[model samples]
Target chain A: MSGKLFRNFSFLSATLSFFLLVGIFAILFTYAQDAMHAFGIDFLFNETWEADEDDEGGVFGGFIPIVGTLLSTIIAMVIATPLAMGIAIFLTEIASPKISKGVSVAIELLAAIPSIIYGMWGLFYFAPIVQKTVGGDGVGLLTAGIVLAIMIIPFMASITRDSMNTTPLVLKESAYAMGATKFEVIKDVIMPYAKGGIIGSIILALGRALGETMAVAFLIGSVMSLPHRITDPTTSIPVLLANNFAEAQDLEMSAMYYLALVLFVVSFVIISAAKFYFFGKKAK
Target chain B: MNRLFVNKLILGLSTLSAVIGIGFLFWILITLSYKGITSIHWSTFTNDLVEGGIRNLLVGQFTMAILASFLAVPLGMMAGIYLREYGHGSKLASVIRNLSDVMMSAPSIVIGVFVFALLVDPFGGYNGWAGIVALAIMMIPIIISTTDNMLALVPKELREAGIALGGSKHKIILQIVIKAAKVGITTGILLSFARIIGETAPLLFTSANNQFFTMDLNGQFPSLTVSIYNLATYPDEASRELAWAASFILTMIVLCINLIGRFVIRNKK
Candidate 1:
């Protein structure tokens, strides 16, 4: 009887705690619903943000920020994915165990540095270099993307390495037994097997880049327009939310909240997709 | 000969890429030190901003971070404990676990917005208390996830031994389970501090940046992060330089926390 009571108590506590966790999502959804009613369907696709105007009211077109987020993340993925794959391949298929362990640890450390530090560094150092080389005023999509590439590289490399390492050794051995070359084994055997995980890692990195605020805000010029070129000044959604929240005008405030909700929904979808892809049936 | 050369070439390229990543980090640290260390005067550490330094902001940041962690760590640990030790395979537990994962991945700015709506807008003003609330919200999920992970790592035999010794479930958890997971819990707390210390976005809306210093929890207090943001954007050259210096200092503090937390966890094993 006492054992059953303890079990019941534990079960009840767990149930309550889980509900508390779900409550956070419920709160976000509630706010999102309110924002939708206030803004309507135009919230998702509109590109013009006129927070100061009346009658036409504050038109909150989110296209520029949306495009900026997607473009920068895509650029980051393009730059990071190959570099991460190379690092993973080198570690798993080439390097000695001692060097591989040390290299992997160093990469993991990069993941721990705060995003704001990356922002400060990008603003102070990287932007100038980018400006000098790329010939821009200072901040733009290219610089933000490059910085994000550096930031997300560790995540991509670590996960890819883990997935590659987990690929059955027997497959690699069999490939070698067939007189296949080293590069051929990795290309034909390892890469194909870890393909799902590699894609999942890229998606996860995309989610991170999309939601990144401080780093992007500092480096990406806070312009509310779409970029015509990688060097053109642009604003991302998180930066928009951060900048507007500080201004605290009524429309600006609501618009910021609406944009934040959009970012949240987009990131939520990407993260859920990544979880499904990486964890497979176990995710359910 | 060609195959051997190609293999060496691939290895060299991989080594070069790894070096580039590490080189960037070193370069950042070197530049931060050069820019910031020059301005490292006694006033920056000793006097209050009203008295011409950031003593108050420094102290305020410390207080706010500590207070937020205090609130967040316990609740998160409790939730984690409830989830890992007692709530196996139940629908409610699964829901909570998934919710915590979502919260973990939710954008920090979104969290800032949520806190502002729930706290600042309702109160019609921003305060340090609101900042603490926002930071605590961010800290909670991290703590819950880490604590739950650590608790799950505790060997079942230890728990069974305590149980066989006629220990109450509460006592077993408190003594055996928690004691084993202490280092991980501490590491979680330290990571939470690292996360909140440099956080500027959520605080942007909720904390309302203060230029001068104030210690009152109900009043606006300048934090190192907001200070960096404000100083960075100022038109003055002095402010921009100072922003770099301040950012350098903030980064060092965060690095110290992370390294120390890692050291502690490593030592425990």
Candidate 2:
């Protein structure tokens, strides 16, 4: 009876602990109800962003930041995905064991650097160079994408490297025996086997890039409009949330929650998509 | 016949890509160090943020981090213990694990909004406590994941030994299992510390950066990362210099925590 009671108690604690996430989701969903009714289905379709400063808490639209988030993340993935795969390929195949380990460890350390540092560096050093070559003063959609690309490369490369490393040795040896070149073996054998992980890593990077704040908040020009050009200023969901959450009142605050709910749901889908890649392998 | 050339070309390109990835790290470090060291001074720590010193920001960071640790560790450890010891392989355990994994990658800023709703609004203000709650939530998932993995690594033989000695499940877990897995648990704690210390987004609205230093958890507080963001955006040279200096300080703290965590985990292995 004592053991039974202890077991029940422990289980109860665990169950309660798990509900914290449920609570978070609850609060977000409940608070966002006001804006859901206010904005209706057009919340996403409305392309213009205007927050009335004249009224204490006024009408606002999140469409521009949503666009910015999508655009910047797409740009980052476009730039980082192939480069990250290349780095992974190099680590798993081309580099010597010693050099690979050294570089791999360095990449791990690179991941340890915080998002804020990346933003600061982008705003200071990287943006200036970008300004010189890429046009505008470097604080725009392009700079934000570049910074995010730099930030997510370590994640994408490390995950992909692990996937590549796990490719069966027998398969590769057989490919080599067929008189195939190294490139052929990778393209035909390794990549096909590790495709799930590669896709997962890229999606994971996308999710991170999408929700990234602070760094993008600094580098992205924070203008609330649809960006027609790479050099055009824009905002993202996270940056908008961080920049305005303090002063927001009533409907404005609820609108932020609505935006938060949007971010929450999008990231949830993207993160689960990342898991689909791993679950395929994890099933084995 | 042309396979050798193709192989050589792909290999060179891939290697170059890896070099570029590594190259960015070095360039950032060198530049940050150069800018940080040249501008940092003794007065920087002795004065206020707008005036000079980051003393308040450092204190606030430590306070909020410690508060977060207090909230995160015991709860996370308990949840981990429940998953590993009591509920292992159960449907509930699997569900909890999946949720934890999803939450692990959830956006931090949304967490800010959640805290703003629950704590910031109810408490009637932005204070260090709200920030602590947000950071603690962020810290929780990481600790649960690590603690579950680490506790599982504690050998079954050890648990069997405890059982043979007529030890109860509670005692076995608290004494033998936790003690055996202590190093890994410590590593997880340190890693979570490294994670929370550098986070800016959750704190962006929760702690709500102040220009002056204050020990009051009830008041808006300064933090290193948040200040660095506010500072770096300024167009002037002096504020930019101070921003770099603060970034250096913040980077070093985060790097040291991570390196120490790596060192400890390596030693344990």
Candidate 3:
């Protein structure tokens, strides 16, 4: 009887993730019906987000924040990928064991810091430096991207390192025996072996950058305009939601639900692709 | 000659990237400690947010996080046990693992929005229970992943030995397999606790923020992180300083817990 009870309870808890995922989707889709009826497909491309003069109902589209989310994630991926790859390479191939261990701890510590702390640091210490060097008012796509890059490098590096470390010793030794240099061994042997994991790590980091709230919220300037340049201010889905989700009502509230639905769907698809198509099979 | 030079260049760049990674970590830590130490006073910890101290915010944040742990830990561990022990590599277990992994990375703010739609909107306002639920949602996937992975690391021989001794399946898992993986699971629990305690996004509209100290779970709660978010954006010097002090303290608490988790695992090895 006790065994049966334990088994049944565990099975129920195991199903919780499926239920939670379905529940979130159902709730968001259910609530977003009004906005879906009003906007249909144009919501993705329509840039205007405003309320009517009476403050009851008006045009609310997802274009600016959607574009902002994509652009910021793009900038972050561009900056973070190469740096993260290099760090992974250093940890897996170049660094001595003691140095590697120390660096690993440092990277872990970096990853452990909260997103909000990154936001505060970026606002005070990093954004000013960006303003002085790169020329914007310091809070824009460029600053947000760079800070987001810093935030994800540790994650990306650690995963990439783990995958790269999985490369067989025999293959590397055979390459070295054939007179291959360190770089050649990495390029020819390790890269091909770890390609799935590396790409998956990059995509996963991209997904993270897309959804990151507080860090980007502080530096993305929270404006609703299209960024004319990389340094120009803009808003993202998360920043928009964080700054404005509370007091919104009526059609606007429905629109917020629509945006949330879009974010959840996009991230869901991205993470699914990374897990199933790229990294999942390889990991198994 | 060209190939050798290229190799040197690539290696040099990789090393430089490692340097850059470490450099940024130190830069953030140093700046945080400097600003945090400068702004902290006895009053900062003694007074509540109304008096510009973090006494209530700290208590409130911990209350929500601890309550969240109480909710997440058991459910997550049971789910993990189901996947690793009971499912026996079944297809259902694999699907749950995949979905749970995907859920682990679902955008946190979306979780907040979902919780708000359910707990806050229907109820008419933010409350401590809403915050706790949102955090538990964020933490469950992480705990599930860790427990599943740690339990997987236990040797098959242990389970066989338990079976040879005529132990029941559930008893074997509870005593033998779980005991074998105890250190790792404990570390995971500690790390997951560290992760949730620092989250600000999910708590943003759920518990929202309050100025005064209140222990009521049905009302708006004071959160150190949410308070930092609100205070840091203010134009006043005092508010910004308070934000700095809070951020510093939060970082220290998170990093120390993280180190302790790592230390426990290291000592085991």
Candidate 4:
């Protein structure tokens, strides 16, 4: 191909993400119109998900799944953020070079394991332990959230470590020369310097936890009923779609579309905020 | 003395946290291997799902993943080439870069939903093509980011030498710049391939699940991950064992590919 033609082709390929984003939004919005009109604003609050006797149409709402998604993600973030910070600190501040490198690889390998495996492992071994120690059935919000926390810890720690590693050695030495305690120096120097990236990594992990499907699917119990407690069974939007979207018909199907749209839009906003607002300036 | 105590306490807690992190990794791996190995049989590799073997699921998963790579690699590499070479420092390049980053983290299931609406809803039903498209969508952003970052690592001095040699822009990029970044790009490709192949959510609805071995793209296809999801939930010992076996194999494939990718880059260095 001619150079100009080749360049144009490349440009077209480069624009694919933008078009795909818009296309997904447009298609979901268009498909979701039936639900939008049928339930209107009440769809967010309506609790009962039921079909008419004919199996043709149904009254569907997103509140249970929406709340489930939010609560599970909140639980995950609360659990993950501190642990991830500690791991980052351990890797950057405490470990010797040789030990640090080996641990880093182990953490990355942990991250590489598929989400489905987490789900299976959670269902079998982890859930039983949770059942014995905690109060509820093996699968619930608490179980799902903790396993999800483990899943995202590696990602958050790696990114946080990268940013912490960027702190200048001279700055650290200056703090130490001033007789600052190790904790004090880290809290005063590295924390302030890498605050943006640290927060960015946390938010990014939050976003991942928000939309995670397989792991949460197995652990969340996939019940439509709202959870009465942290250990109670409930379903999230992705789980709801994964299990029910195919069998749904007419208005119920449209409601599923509406849920997917909400998920896509919320994640788009969250990930974009983390990228542009937090990491935008120093990302390169 | 109080300051020293606080430092020691915080340091101890951080060390405990790393231990907890590593502890979970070994816990899962050990459990997976013990269960997987105990359940494996000679027939496990020879039979299809209809006869209770994983041969078809493996083939099906590989077929879709490889086809996705075929679609994504060329398009993603071209996009990366545009970002680093032709559109360097341009307004449009920056915009695409940011969008691709956002796309990278957008939930995989939403991509499945989008593909279902476009390919499955209109085309009548679940098919291999829809599954491939959903996976391709997931793979493209990953490939784009990798290719972009890898190409950016090529030195400016090298490009200047190509220009001094009177090579065309495309020729220089194809022959010199891309060659310089080949190892990094290959590793990226391999890593992305591992990511997409392990995905269960996107294929959950797109390919649904087939009980029999079939190569037809117009019909439902077997998926190892999706089948594991279905089988694990079944209230039977046999199916549960199969699920464990499948999960072990899938994890091994993913982790091995990742190790190989790291090894390749380390060897180059």
Candidate 5:
């Protein structure tokens, strides 16, 4: 009877906790619905954001911000993925354990620093450096993208290294015994085995890049239009939300809310997919 | 001979990139310190933010962070405890865990916007209390995930042993289970502290920045992060220098917290 009572209590608490968790999503969905009703689907595709009064005739195209987000994130991935993979291969396959431990800790410390510091550094030091070297205005998609790549490299490298390390040692040894070169063994056996984890890490990093705000806000000049060149001034969705939500008119506020909802959904899907791919089977 | 040299060359190139990456991080720290450390004097700590000092901002950050952690840790621990211990195959538990994961990864700015909509706009003014609420919401999911992870690490045999001793479920958790997981729990709290201390975007909408010192949780307050943002943008080089200094201070606090957390966990083993 005591055992049964304990079990029932545990079940009750678990159920209550779950309901609370789902409640957060429900609240987000309700807010999204209200925001959508206020603006309609046009809120998403509209680009013009004239929040000023008297002349409220601007269309609500969100393409610029969306493009800004995708462009910077893609740029970051392009820069970070190769470096991260190289670092991972170096750490797991080549470095001695003592050196690897030290390097790993240093990378983890990089991850723990605040995003705002990154913003401050970018605004003060990095932006000027870029402006001087690139021979143009500092603020653009390229600058923001490079800063993000540096910020995210540690995240991607650590995860990739862990996954690569998990590759069966025996398999690598057998390939080596058969006279396969180190690079050949890695390309053939290790990379394939860790493919799921590597993909998951990239997806996670992409999610982070899409959602980052303070750093991007500092680097990306808040031009609401899409740039034809990577070095052209542009605005991302998160930066727009940060810039506009403070003094937004009612319609603009609702539109910003809609944008926020879209961002939330995109990140939610990416993270959920990564989780399912990486941990779903083991979870059962 | 050429092929062998080529392999060595490839290895050297990869090693060089890794060294460069590590070097970049140290460069940032050294630069920040050089720019900011000169301003770290006595007057800076005793004066208010309006007078070009961060005394009030420092106090406000400490107070708000502690309050938010106080609210977040208990509730998060309860939720985590419930999920890990009581949640077997329950649909509700699975949903909650998934939602918590999503919430954990949601951008800090989104949380700010949500809190602004839910609390500040309705209240018709920015308040420190609203900021606290926002930070707490951000902290909760992290705490819950950490606590659940730590609890999961507790051995099944220990739990069974407690059960066999005629202790109630709650007693078992309160006594045997949590005691074993104390180091992990402390690490979670420390990580949460590190996380909330540096957050800026969420506070942007929830707690409007104040130049003067204010202590009331219901009143406007300035934090280290908001102050840094405000300072970094000023036309004055002094303010920019101060911002770097403040950034250094904030980073030190976070690094110390993380190091202490690791130490605690390591010592426990």
Candidate 6:
């Protein structure tokens, strides 16, 4: 009887984290009620992000940060997807198995490298080089996007490779047996079958690019205004929260939670979609 | 043929693209080593951030990481065992499994906010312990999934062999399957550790940053990643150089962990 009870206890402990996630959403929602009540729809639409030091009323607007997050994520996805696809193709199709495994390990390590180091490299090394050519102070949206692209390439590439490789060997061989060239087989057979999964990887990459803080925080121009060009500096929602939360007082702190909430919800949708597609492939 | 030329061009670009991607990794490693290796002041491991030593922050960072691992490793493994051993195909298992995957990819900042709201809010300030909770939260899902996946890979034949000897479920799990999958579970734990070591965003809101030495868990504590951020953003050249050192240390630590983990996994196979 005691052993059975202990078994049940272990199961209960396992479920606690799922409950913890639910609790997080609840706590964030409750705390955000202040900003929710104050800003109402304006929280989602307003662009200005100012807060008076003593005002205590707190600033609450989502427009610029939301736009910045979306724009940078878009930039990252657009730039990373093709490069990732290229790497994935080369690895799966061109490289020897041993070389591919070595590169694969390298790519996996790339994904594991923490975000802060990437931020430091971008700020110190990549930004200066970009600044020289862009004709502006280089730490801006474009640089951030480029660094983000580099950071996410391994993730997208590996995912793309895995999904693409799932296309059956027999199918590819049959295409080859028809006198189809390598390009013909890839374009006609592999690409079509892997389309949904490749897309899923990109979406997952999008979620990553959106919530990333350290890497973009340095390179992206941290400002309140809209980025007029990719070269212009901007602040992502995560950046805003990171830069402000420590300094924020009372209601302002709650407003930052609202920003976290927004980021959380956006990532939730994209990540879920990506998981749905990527894992759902296995079920089939 | 025209098609052959186009194919060759595409293949060349793909290889070039892979080269560029791998090239960046080497470039960062080389640059970090070049600058950071020369700045090896033994004092770095002993000094406070403002005083130019990263000893306190490193301690604080590891304290949080170790505490988090202690918290996450068990619960995550339990969750994994539950999913694999008992709950497979159950509605609760499926929901939890999917949710765990989603949470595995959840934004670190969001998890920080969650713990900050849940723990820090009640305490009225940032402290080292709150950061531990946040970091632990991030580690849980990864460990859970890895535990589940690794334990599943333990052959059914092993379990049945133990069962034939009249072993209870718990005994079979603890004495047999867990032992078999020990290496994988350790790899998962180490990878999760590496993932959180250089984390800055979550620490930004939870532990915040401490410039001076303080070992107090419930109070503000110095942390390496946060210090790197603070140092890197400073306008002064000295601070930036220190930032590179910190980056080098962090990158090296993470790389070493990865190398060790990969080597171990390879050896296990």
- Give me the displacement of residue A184 in model 3, in angstroms: 0.9
> Which docking category, incorrect, acceptable, medium or high, applies to candidate 4?
high
Candidate 2 lDDT over residue span B1-269, tens digit each: 68789888888889988999889999988999999999899988898886777888888888899999998887788788888998788878877777777788889998888888888888888898899999999998888888899999898999999999999998888889999999999988998899899999999888888889788889898888888888887788998999899888888888888889888978977
Over A1-284, each residue of candidate 5 has an lDDT whose tens digit, in order, gives: 46556556545543443453355455556655645775577766766766555534334667789989999999999999988888888899888999988888788778888888888888778888988887558988988998899889999999999889899889999999997777777788998999988998998899999999988988888888778877887999899988778787655666677777788779989998987876453463
Q: Estimate, for each residue in A112-218, the C-alpha lDDT of model 2 and write its tens digit.
A: 88899999899878988988998886789999998899999999999999999999999999999998889999999999999888898888888889898988998
Top candidate, metric lDDT: 3
Q: Which stretches of candidate 5 lie over 4 Å from their true place?
A: A1-39, A55-58, B1-10, B89-91
Retained true contacts (fraction), each candidate: 0.43, 0.67, 0.84, 0.85, 0.39, 0.66
**Model 4: per-residue Cα lDDT over B225-258, one tens digit each:** 9999999999999999999999999999999999
* DockQ of every candidate structure: 0.43, 0.62, 0.88, 0.87, 0.47, 0.69
lDDT order of candidates, best first? 3, 4, 2, 6, 5, 1
TM-score of chain B of each: 0.94, 0.96, 0.99, 0.99, 0.95, 0.97
lDDT of 5 at B214: 84
Q: Please list the residue runs of candidate 2 whose C-alpha ends up more than 4 Å from where it truly belongs after superposition.
A: A1-13, A51-58, A281-284
- Model 6 global lDDT (CA atoms, 0 to 1): 0.86
Q: After superposing candidate 3, which stretches have Cα over 4 Å from the reference?
A: A282-284
The segments of candidate 1 whose C-alpha lies over 4 angstroms from its true place after superposition are: A1-39, A52-56, A168-171, A281-284, B1-10, B50-52
Residue runs of model 4 more than 4 Å from their true location after superposition: A282-284
Model 6 residue-pair collision total: 1
lDDT of 1 by residue, B12-78 (tens): 7776777887787788788888988986677778866555466777787888889998878877887
B1-269: candidate 6 lDDT, tens digit per residue: 99888788888888988899889999888888988987769888878887888888788888899998999988899888888887876878877888888788888888877877777878988889899988988889999989989998899999999999999988888889999999999998888899988788888879888988888988887888998899887899888888888889989999898888878898988
Shift in Å, residue A214, candidate 6: 0.5
Off by more than 4 A, model 6: A281-284
For candidate 5 chain A, the 10 contiguous residues with the lowest summed lDDT are: A13-22
Count of backbone collisions within predicted model 4: 0
| Model 1: per-residue Cα lDDT over A38-152, one tens digit each | 6688776878777555523456667889888888888888998888878888789888999898787677667777787788889878999999998887799999999999999
Per-candidate TM-score against the hidden true structure: 0.91, 0.95, 0.99, 0.99, 0.93, 0.97
List per-candidate RMSD values in Å.
3.1, 2.2, 0.9, 0.9, 2.8, 1.7
lDDT of 5 by residue, B1-269 (tens): 66466557666766776886797689778877787798676777888888888888888888888999988887788777777787745776777777777678787887788778777888888889888988988888888888888998999899999989988877788788888888899899998889898888888888867888888767677888888877888899779877887899998888888889888887888
> What's the distance in Å from true for residue B107, model 2?
0.6
The i-RMS of every model, in angstroms, reads 3.4, 2.2, 0.7, 0.8, 3.2, 1.6
